[model samples]
Target: MSLTKFIEEKEVRNLIDNYVDKPKFDLCAEIKANPQTKSYALVGTAFDYLMRFHFEYKYSIIDNCHWVAHNSLVYLLIDNFKLGIEPVKPIAFLTEMNFKDIYNDSILDVKDLQEKLKEKNDYKGRQIFKVINLILNAEKEYSNFLKSGNLTDGVIKATIDLAKIDVIYRRKHYPNDLGEYKEGNIQDLKQLYKIIPDFSKKKDSNILLNPTFDKASQLVGGADCDIIIDETLLDIKTTKSLRFTRKYFRQLIGYAILADISVNIKKPKNLGIYYSRFAKQFVFNSDIVYETDEYEILKDEFKKKANKIYG
Candidate 1:
């Protein structure tokens, strides 16, 4: 789950004010810095070829440097579709040619990403294209949901909207699949409405949250986009929540402050929460429900409550 910048900043600031004399670091920055050091690197000539140019190709010249050129062409097809939300014309081709992602189902793991490059397989060649086709089908369905074949507001009114919750993890994408420490976020969203920004199969939504900080400086929370959506700082949280909780709210509160303070924007009028339930594919994707920040309160109240929890 995600940790809000607001909560992190408060904790770090408290530590400096109460725990340390000189105050070595902000709690937000210290917490954020823990996982920044590890990024996966690619290896070998074959692997390097894939990451640089070959991977760029939908399908290119076979590894043997033969004239098949399947990798480059196929890769281009996937990239074109991925780069845009539109249904690629050649999606039908995917049904015939079967290829698989070199990496397994655990796409989140860096090892899995690397395994793609380290290994080679003819059987897996066209699998990714087929998968992209399935994603397109989902997008089509969501689109039809958006339009009611007429000007009736029914399609949109019944729709759910969402913002991407980008949790800044030093090394991991999230503490856990549903984004651990995100319980507070659920509380907020359930108060608002359900929104699903993603429809394409495995089409992930992202929001930029990581702010590069100077050593020994306060972890200022603002970033480029946070300054834009001014009325409210939305964190579209996807987590397990039949009801709300405290930890999740702090996360949203933290994000709210970061969004406002970092960009020099005014605090939003409303802080919303988004709740999406999960299935066992190790992924959370369904026409799930969500809502906005229901349990609003003063930061001091959060601080007093948080202090007790941490203690």
Candidate 2:
């Protein structure tokens, strides 16, 4: 069943309107300082930031790497098409095959991108080319859907097709490369590509809420959520399986609590983890839903823990 339908009435347009006066905090700095000492505290910040990028921005920060950049660009392209919206910013492609200086100017042509990918003779180059080809070929297979497709149903078939391709090549090219710093990111694309259509078709506009909330340095610390779809709080886990472990659950619940105290918005009715690699969503409703009791408990726990490190 589509869990999203159950939480429609609980969503609010501006979740932060009531608490505009809250003070802000910059937890990113704390997360960067000697992670060895406060690893647990940092984990929440790190995961929250990563999900914000993946869910809200639809791009990964680690995509700065060339190998990962290819996937990021392709995903961005597909997302734009699926959303029935044009790219908000112009996208640039590398003019040369040199990994260091691959980009020149932003070009929106898929064929031009493919042409450039073909020119590279190196192993990494070939790897990128193959992934791009997978997307291109998938696009061709689903060209029909792209024709009359609204934001609702663009091309889910192509996603499964790409998943079936053997794109995981020998690590001859950048074996040590951390594409998006998340394992199975390339493989997980198949799942993300397939699942996004389901979200777009929902009653909500699928708009991303304030991706970051650095405005709570006063009563509480800074906090952010992954994807605020309508009234749901969704986080993406690129992990191969759905492991709602305590640490993971705490991290998500922390975001919910932070969202409530900092933004004065009612806690989300639904919380979801999109296990991208598995192409499945493990959703939690009333059972694990954030409430004032849980919120106060977590708030005290977080502040106590965060203060130990920050102080």
Q: How displaced is residue 217 in candidate 1, in Å?
A: 17
Candidate 1's residue-wise lDDT over 1-26, tens digit each?
A: 12334345555445323321221211
Once fitted onto the true fold, the runs of candidate 2 whose alpha carbons sit more than 4 angstroms away are 1-192, 195-197, 203-206, 217-223, 264-266, 286-289, 292-297
Q: Compared with the true structure, what per-residue lDDT tens digits does model 2 show for residues 189-219?
A: 3234444425444443444543444343232
Note each model's CA RMSD in angstroms. 19.4, 15.4
| Candidate 2 minimal-lDDT segment of 10 residues | 1-10
Against the hidden true structure, what lDDT does model 1 obtain? 0.28
Error of 2 at 280 (Å): 2.0
